[model samples]
Target: MPDGQSTRTAMFRVKNLWIIHLLGWVLFMSLPLTIVSREPSAGFPVRILQSGWFSSFFLVYATLFYGNLLVLVPKLYLKQHYVAYAAVFVGLLVAIYFSKPFERLIFRNFRQEQGRELRPEPPREGFREGRPPRPPHGGDARPMPRPNGERAVDFVSLTLFIVVWAVAMAIRISREWRQSERRAILSEAEKAHAELSFFKAQINPHFLFNTLNNIYALAVSSSAHTAPSILKLSQMMRYITEEATENYVPLEDELACLENYVELQKLRLNAKTSLDYEVKGQPEGIRIAPLILMTFVENAFKYGVSNHRESVIRIAVEVAGGDIRFLCQNRIIERNREEERTGVGILNTQKRLDLLYSGFYDFDIHNDGEIFTVKLKLPGR
Candidate 1:
């Protein structure tokens, strides 16, 4: 089935073809009389005009049989039958050439046209002594055979045929151009979706492994706070398992993950350690990519707070001016002199953010004295 565009294109193609053919037919059949006449005498102009008018009268009839055959091809033959097409085409050509103006009263007042298949009154040749037949109705008498003039007709009509074919070819080209553009857009979307899915895969596994490691550490210590640590870890897992499937989670869900992570870390806090945090966003309806915020919080616990004797952790996040602004700072108490700085977790988290919010984020990392900070600003209304 054709869509709206294809249907419209097809209709235009049909109209264009006929317009080309009609213009060509008029120009060619009228040319000798209307434009190319070598006549200096009025009589020649009148004769050409009569012939041109005669040919113009049968234009549609000629198209009904011949033009349709050219366009519809063998379909026309199958419908009208091959013999019928040939017979009508040949008979019409012969009639245009040989039909007598007054041939209707020769054989007992019954005069008919003459052709290979037509029978008219036998020629009255001065009653067989070389006179042209007395055409019926006694209006005139003439004897002549008009040639097909096939070369002239072919030169004119085939030129019009080529124009029609060119228009159809143009329609096909335009349709393909549109289809190609649509395909290009779809391909670009698929590329983006694949990039996002890879980012998701990279971040999720890194997150789960880190959380499991925290659980392992608590399990090894076997402190009185172990049960609640296990509970917090379980809640974090629930958040991951449920919310990770979604494209975006509520901003509060991200805040809750950070809180759970902080609670679990509290079970292991040294007496000198301190944590400071604030969340001022409208957490109810605001949405964020799943697990986006926790990476900074987790980094605070993993690098700065985990290594310090009396470390400081500070977090501030709020929706300001239609933006989600996040900041995390912790003391980098134990800097390593010789080690790779790009951990798998941090690297994966960076990629996930790049995919999710390509230009919508501002991420900065800085270490001032003993404090390390990850500052992020993202946009959502």
Candidate 2:
């Protein structure tokens, strides 16, 4: 396998084992030195050269064991810090017990067998050849295993093992922390999606309520076009309820909705008030979020039509290929706080735009003391 693939596979497989791995590595790294470092003064580092891939057996098993302990320790006994520490301490002893017996066997047996293979050659510095080695008693002529400083190695191995365990546990703990953060971000997104759906649902009832009220007024006034009003309303209602739920709706359908809404509003208003609606750039089939433009439309009608004064609502939409621009401007009446406060509905609409468009939208809201203006330009990617 390639290096990256091998590392990834090892990471997945070893993320769960613990103590058994610690014992295995301690034995693997130490065994070669004990066995093959026979003639320690022979000027050859046989422990390393001869260790070979057999050492990897030790590496894989030992790392896995240490990793397992890290996960299991914190998961099962986190609140009981003292007990977890105790279990670790006991596990250490058992690991050494199973692993220590190998040191003596590795050194003593491999060398003894190897020495016998090339016997009677007076093996040199290791056993003190010929007359045997000293015993502080002067009564033997047999070759014996040389002193390879086993006690010193015992201290070194134990110290190194403790250090390895500490480092391995830290890695596992850090990985756990990152996984938790990913889960938290996903949960927040789900909540925002639900909130957007709820806000989107509110627009339907508000639009219906206002439109029905206008139709009722026309009926009472006995206008000649009441039938046309009801028919326009049916079309608008069907268009909104059936199509707006989709991700995007044709710009023409949305404009038709706005036109129907304007016609409905005109029935209540006298002919002197002004409204300008324009579509520049042949923006017929361009798509947009359902009802994204409706809030601005409703706001314009609510505040722009003066009962007996000159008032204007100007709305213009321009679409060209992948770009769309919508501009809504209304006269700002200083004394009408209720109509101005209804402007807060724009906040919910702005939030939806942020979620859906992100980098693709430019929205500007400004009031130059007389005119309240909103400009939004969105580009498709």
> All models: lDDT?
0.64, 0.71
**What's the C-alpha lDDT at position 85 in model 1?**
53
How well does candidate 1 match the true structure in TM-score terms?
A: 0.54
Candidate 2 regions exceeding 4 Å error are 1-147, 154-175, 282-286, 334-344
List, residue by residue over 1-381, the lDDT tens digit for candidate 2: 799999998887676444645665665576556555546645334543454344543454466445555555576444457677668656875676456533453444445545655647555564653665455567666656567545434443455456556655666667667878888988878877786677778878888888898888888989887999999999998997899876578878888898888788877766757888888886655788778888987887887777677778898988877788899999865555554556337888888888777778999999888888999998643
What TM-score do all the candidates reach, one by one? Answer: 0.54, 0.69
The lowest-lDDT stretch of 10 consecutive residues in candidate 1 is 104-113
Q: lDDT of candidate 1?
A: 0.64
- lDDT string for model 1 (286-351, tens) is 888887777778777767654337778888888877789988898876657653243455676677
Clashing pairs in 2: 16-68, 17-68, 18-65, 18-66, 18-68, 18-69, 21-62, 21-65
- Report lDDT (Cα) of residue 196, candidate 1: 64
